[model samples]
Target: MDLFADDTRLTPMPIDDGELWFQQRLPLDLAPDEVMRRLLAETGWREEEIQVWGKLHKQPRLSAWHGEASYRYSGKTFHPQPFTALQLHIKQTVERVTGRRFNSVLLNYYRDERDSMGFHADDERELGPEPAIASVSFGAPRTFILKHRHLPKKVQLALGDGCLLLMAGALQKHWLHGINKERTPRGPRINLTFRLIL
Candidate 1:
């Protein structure tokens, strides 16, 4: 993929010794609020009502592969839900950024202070070995942290409004990222992580 073209108005944020880069607060071609409203109306984000691994999991969740019933996690099976058009649209924009295609997207809606995802790597068996995951943040600003699996330093990025965070090359193999829970009041945030499932 072309690293940076004249048409692409994204500035790369550097990282330590790894291939992780992000363009913070870059303006998207679409209006942020309009896109958010369209996504909320189109995407059927259901309030999840389940308890798994002693943690509360929500609905409107789909796996990397479509039409799959069991999303294997720690030797257990979990069902998947359907995806919305907004998910597909975000994926396409991410593809344009990286000049690579992605087949699936994992959408997480942080409703409030209580909703959060645990720390984990995107090391799924289907995502190949060195996957490129393009994460686009919409709506509210949130702090996304990454702790090196083998290094000493930890990185943090305030993913505000409309921004694109791309984790490419060998990032997933060496780093684990997550969104930490904050105490302050915040609006709903929808994150679309674009991944290519092999």
Candidate 2:
């Protein structure tokens, strides 16, 4: 597939070493509030302890795994949960947009401003080289940060409700991305990242 196809809905980001496509809002028809409510009520959200620097600490946010393949991260293996109706619908829609097939999804639920994720790259072996990650956000808006691995350049964007961020090409190999904690008040937010696990 042509990575830089001239699509009216896709806005190419200005990053030197990677290809990113940003869409402020996706045409999912479902309201953001309704999606959040369904996910919260149906999905099994859990907090797992991760080992960092020889110490174990509880993850700041809730997470769930759903799809056909298992995922391993932070030295833990996550068995896949059967995809719910809502998840399957969203997955199909995203697949149509990116023209990519995804077999797994990792869902992160940020309860409030205090919940945050540290900077990290998604260049895991299972994802293969030049993996394409389709991220969809719902509910509260959060700032997404991407920093070049060896350069003094950074890209920051606010991912509001219903926004879709596609990270493809060599982005994960050359840059790191994360969502930082906010001091001010904010509502809950959910980020779903669909991936193809080889």
Candidate 3:
């Protein structure tokens, strides 16, 4: 499939040695709030622990893995759960907008101000060279931080409700991206990152 041929609405985000495209809103069958509510109730969510630097620590957020492939990260392997009807609908919508194919999805839920993820690259070997990752967010907005690996550069993106962010080309190899905990109270938010596992 020619993934980039028909994507006309995505705005390019500038960065060194990487590619990014952002759409303020994604096309969906249901309202973003309704979808968020369904996701909060129907999907299975897990609080996981990861080993870092010989120490085990619990992840600050709840997550679920879905689609055809299992995923491994942070010294743990996540077996896949078959996608729900709603999730499949979301996956299809994402595919249509991005014109990219994906066989797996990582769904993350941040309950409030205390949940966060540190800066990290998604350049796992199974993602192949130059994987295209599409991120779709629902609910409240949060800052997405990106930093260059070898340059004194940083970018902060406010990923709001129902938006789409596509990270492609050499983005994973050249930059680190993450979300930080907010000092003030924030509303619940959910993000889905779709990937094609090789």
Candidate 4:
């Protein structure tokens, strides 16, 4: 038998100029499917418009913010609604696993294969220096792509159901990441990114 096979901890994903830790599945009281269903039924998702190059356009995906602080990006400010009980629990679990405290969460819902996000980094000034963000996913899998800002390098991750990914260190300073739209039909997905705003 292979030693360390049963270890249920986040594995370090080596990359230049950044730190990544991933766990294929996070143990929870309820199943990932159940959590997905609950979030679908409970969240007040909205399709917000943002200005890109001086033109406003609706974001491809629906999203909600829940936390104690306001967030600003893309020329818009979002004053979050209070976190739900389930979201609070999720934050607690994420904090316990990652050893990081997060006061905010940005939840994004990809309704289908057509929904996608453009490449960007979470390098906002309010995040302070060397910030850490924990992302948890439920439901359909998606290919997450990361591209270096000034280098010809790329990385990909298959973000599956119940998986957790942590982006830390100089990642925001050197890399950009996003999810591209896929042609094939796909089910819905929800991703919650836990963060601490200074």
Candidate 5:
């Protein structure tokens, strides 16, 4: 983990395919613990607290995005949850490192060993084609899996606390990714995925 660095540029994906570029690393100013605490306190999100689905309409999981009423599911709409100072700091750092401005972000809080996101692409219409997604992970380390859409190759990365991952280009078109909830003891994790919504 590149902890305590202000920001670091990452290796860009090879470009035989069209549409995608990215960078990943921990934000320079905040420590891992500080990021976690502020996220929990500001969101008023208790560990394992499940909110109504905000984006993915077809899934049995907890999710939140944009705080838009139209984006809500399960009878509860969130009014654009304000970003904490830590969130803004990280976002700025990401923008600097990736050289891309992100208008909106989607926050996914995975509590303990049960909360998990199923396989899917970040290919929403608002994301536009060849979307650039910069993901910053805090708290417990989790396995992020990527599988080819037509090919059989699968890749996995252990996202340690304060690790940053970037997915860009046609990676979304040719691949799908997700966090699986099997049977392993884990701590709370806050994932901030910065995106550009058209």
Candidate 6:
């Protein structure tokens, strides 16, 4: 399961501030379509209502939490559900590539072009300092954006299906990342962000 031990496809994302590794397509035997279908059918996806500026609004996408501990964000607490077999397998694969152990994963389902995530840092207290996040994508491709905390520079990446993006070191501390809503029509997509829940 050592994905980078012999592979030459692993490439570091060209960023000036933080550590990021990007693989256009992970070297895995599982089919992206199959994985997407299974996750859609099996995951208990829910549209959570989050409070922003004292106003309650439904999250644009469906999401589920799986792991060994609870995750708190946006003034809400999410308890972990038992990891599905497919999820555990994928987690192990990502861990092998990133060299990081994750006890929890946040699954986000973007049903269409309108579903999106706003810019934010994954600097929750429970994640501790300098957390490593391994993100895997399936299904349709989407644009992932990263902006510096204080500067005007930004990084834009097209995260393809079956691709893996690893963010470690001071990435979260110095940059904010998010996926904006696409204006053009697009198919559904699933994103799995594996993290260590301390």
**lDDT tens per residue, model 2, 104-134:** 9999999999999999999989999999999
Best candidate, TM-score: 4
- Per-residue alpha-carbon lDDT of candidate 1 for residues 1-198, written as tens digits (9 for 90 to 100): 212222245555566545766665434567888777776676655554456677665533322322223344444443445555556566666667667787666667787766676677888787788888888777888888888898786888778677787887878888888877789987888787776656
Which parts of model 1 have CA positions greater than 4 angstroms off?
Answer: 1-8, 25-28, 47-83
lDDT of 6 by residue, 31-87 (tens): 889999999999999999987888889999999999999999888899999999999
Candidate 5 residues 87-130, lDDT tens each?
A: 67888888887778886667788877677887878776556778
lDDT of 4 by residue, 112-176 (tens): 99999999999999998798999999999999888999999898888889988899999999999
Q: Is candidate 4 or candidate 5 better by TM-score?
A: 4
Cα-based TM-score, every candidate: 0.78, 0.94, 0.95, 0.96, 0.77, 0.94
Each prediction's whole-model lDDT (CA): 0.67, 0.88, 0.89, 0.91, 0.67, 0.88
Point out the higher-scoring one by TM-score: 1 or 3: 3
The residue-level lDDT of candidate 1 at 15 comes to 67
Better of 1 and 3 by lDDT: 3
Stronger candidate by lDDT (1 vs 5) = 5
Q: Worst lDDT window (10 residues) for model 4? A: 1-10
By lDDT: ranked, best first: 4, 3, 6, 2, 5, 1
Per-candidate count of clashing residue pairs (backbone under 3 Å): 1, 0, 0, 0, 6, 0
For residues 88-119, could you state the per-residue lDDT of candidate 3 as single tens digits? Answer: 99999889878899999999999998999988
